[model samples]
Target: MTERQQHKRRRGAGVAAGVLCVCLAGSGCAQSGAAAEDAREGEAVQAVRSAADALVGARSSKARTSMEMATGGTRVTIRGEGVYDFRRQIGQLKVQLPQDPAGTPDQRPIMELLAPGALFMKNRGAGVPADKWVRVETRSLSDGNLVTGGATDPFAAAEVLRGARTATYVGEDEIAGTPVRHYRGTADLGIAAQDASDGNKESLAAAAKGFATDKVPFDVYLDEAGRIRKVRHRFSFVNGQMNNAVAVASTTLLYDFGAPVDVRLPDGDDIYAGKIAEE
Candidate 1:
């Protein structure tokens, strides 16, 4: 694969791996293990629910947030360092990669070692194409979740995501050197963007072109402390049959009590350059 493709794969893997760390609180193997996993999972789910609320109340220029969770047979973790650039009118979300697959959070991602600059600086611009196509590039970390920086997007959505099912806490378990409680359940995240006309046509198109044409669903998990443990995401992409399924699995941890996260808006040149490349 090309270096760019490799980077995208690596970053995607990192996010999934990082999320796995905090999201999935492992279950006990035998009957005893199952009981242990159940005990703490409920608490973990509650913690995440509360943290999501706290994020909604925060307004910081910069901060760090992490979450952990578990889904069907999978553990995910995600870590992020957010930078708010007022001049730019956006937030710079820097996510680290997972160091250990067994459930270690990405305290540090070797992203720099891969390459820098606007990951898809050469794409149809700073955002996806407006035509609803699948354009994969080595972009920077996400401000929070699937969508970019905004209230209705993944990061902001988490803060006000109601309709969450009660979680059952499982007991503590050790993963990648960390001890955690486990929680299990599916989170029905009905996210609707308030403003779908943010001007990032390419980006939106690219993202939208996939799911509808294919079938995808959202799966979630939590840790013993009620923190998000894992998220198993399966979606349809433009290259449905030929390409592997487009899935995002993540975990979160180390939430910043009430810190605000700033997301930087892409500049004119970033988008223009990407458009030019596409042209």
Candidate 2:
């Protein structure tokens, strides 16, 4: 791997670890050695379901996210820090991008603001102005394509767990020094994404991409209070012209529930009036 690739990999791993810390600190898991062995199959699954409910019902949270994927022979890795507010249905992310080997020097990292109706992206590169933020309509994002969109929502992890066909307790593990119960599942992607998207599909190709595999694996960790602490998953797809693209995501929830999160819109002078082409 090149230095840039190695750097991205390290950052991705760091984000993963950071997410664990967020989960542990947010949920405030206490150390209890017997809780792991005392867990019952049915009870553990129910606890996970309850945690999923709480996560979906949460108002706002701080999150760290990482995704590494290959699409059409180009590998892309993204690491992000952000806060999501379900009450406002909006979030803002500071994203780190790999340097472009084929571009001029001085390209800055990107910033993204996501809302239910729109996504705003700001990047400094050739042909793109430094002061403008590109506006993207999110209707196409409802096509269940993680690449195109859908991962921005903090509740996406809980939705994945709710759609699991089989959820198995995987014992306990320490995340950021806090004890948590681990659960693994094979989730039906169609159902999971559809649930997240409300079954809206603007692009048939994008909607069908995840169906290449009827199911995908997901893991979740829960604190003793039955609240979700962290989630991790790997996703792969091969269809149309995408080749065999694969993505892995690790997300950690931070702070207590109902913590205030403010995601303000960009100033009018800084907002670009033009629309972005579909991803």
Candidate 3:
């Protein structure tokens, strides 16, 4: 072979090698970018899972709650305001029900005392004496008192995030004038029950079984301290009366961290034992 022809062949080989090197380098860069994205997603999920613990660190906070239920083309909204003690797993709320079909004047608000394993209510309007409180076991309620009480317990609502299966950091936002990071996710109720504290274990487990699906979709906002400023959960359960599924959207907003919350349970004598009328 001619020397010039040999030199040209060598040159061609070098060019081919260079092209292969560039392709490999590009692949490595793509992989690195994907790995970084995965790491960011993992951090967001970890932040969300730890939000409940952050609230516990804050001790207590003032809260506002709204629960909207839709069934058979009818929708009703219930609102409540109160204070919660995360450490004690207790709180108090005054819940106002929507107006009746006749558009009657607003009814007296139902005063509720929320505890770890029990719930107490006065003026519940089921034939119980107004002066007496009615006590119910949290685990006994089909929805685990999440829907029955007309408001989700603040701490319990936070605990639900413990089961976040998938999460994405949406962006920064403000809630009630406080800067917060918004996250969207879906949580598994069964998984939440497994990781929940002893006081909430049975109740959450019951909710997991009673709901139409164990999956709960939620949007949560967290402050700089990783505390939950707001959370909204969408729950669905079968309505026994209508023999259809009812959709419920429950929202809880927390602010005024370090607020005083004094929730005293009623004495046994102060609770009514009579058969209560059904709604």
The global C-alpha lDDT for each of the candidates, from Candidate 1 onward, is: 0.37, 0.62, 0.92
Taking all chains together, the TM-score of candidate 3 against the true structure is 0.95
State the TM-score for model 1. Answer: 0.38
Encode model 2's per-residue lDDT on 34-108: one tens digit a residue: 455345555655665566456546767777766666645777666777887755657777777655557657345
Cα misplacement distance, residue 162 of candidate 2 (Å) = 2.0
Lowest summed lDDT across 10 adjacent residues in model 1 is found at 110-119
User: How large is the C-alpha RMSD of every model relative to the true structure?
Assistant: 22.9, 20.2, 1.5
Clashing pairs in 3: none
State model 3's lDDT.
0.92
Ranking by TM-score: 3, 2, 1
Point out where model 3 deviates above 4 Å.
1-8
Best candidate (score: lDDT): 3
Superposition error at 121 for model 2 (Å): 1.5
For each candidate in turn, the TM-score is 0.38, 0.66, 0.95
What is the RMSD, in Å, between candidate 3 and the native fold over all Cα?
1.5
Query: Between which residue pairs do clashes occur in model 2?
Result: none
Writing each residue's lDDT as its tens digit, candidate 3 over 41-121 gives 889888988998999999999999999987547899999999999999989999999997788999999999999988999
Q: Write the per-residue lDDT of candidate 1 for residues 1-279, one digit (tens) a residue.
A: 699999999999999998886456442236567677666666545554554433334432343434343434455555655443222223444555445556656343311100111221121222445432222241222221232211112333233223234455444665444455544443433222222222222233344343333222333443343333333333333224444433443332333333454333344443432333432
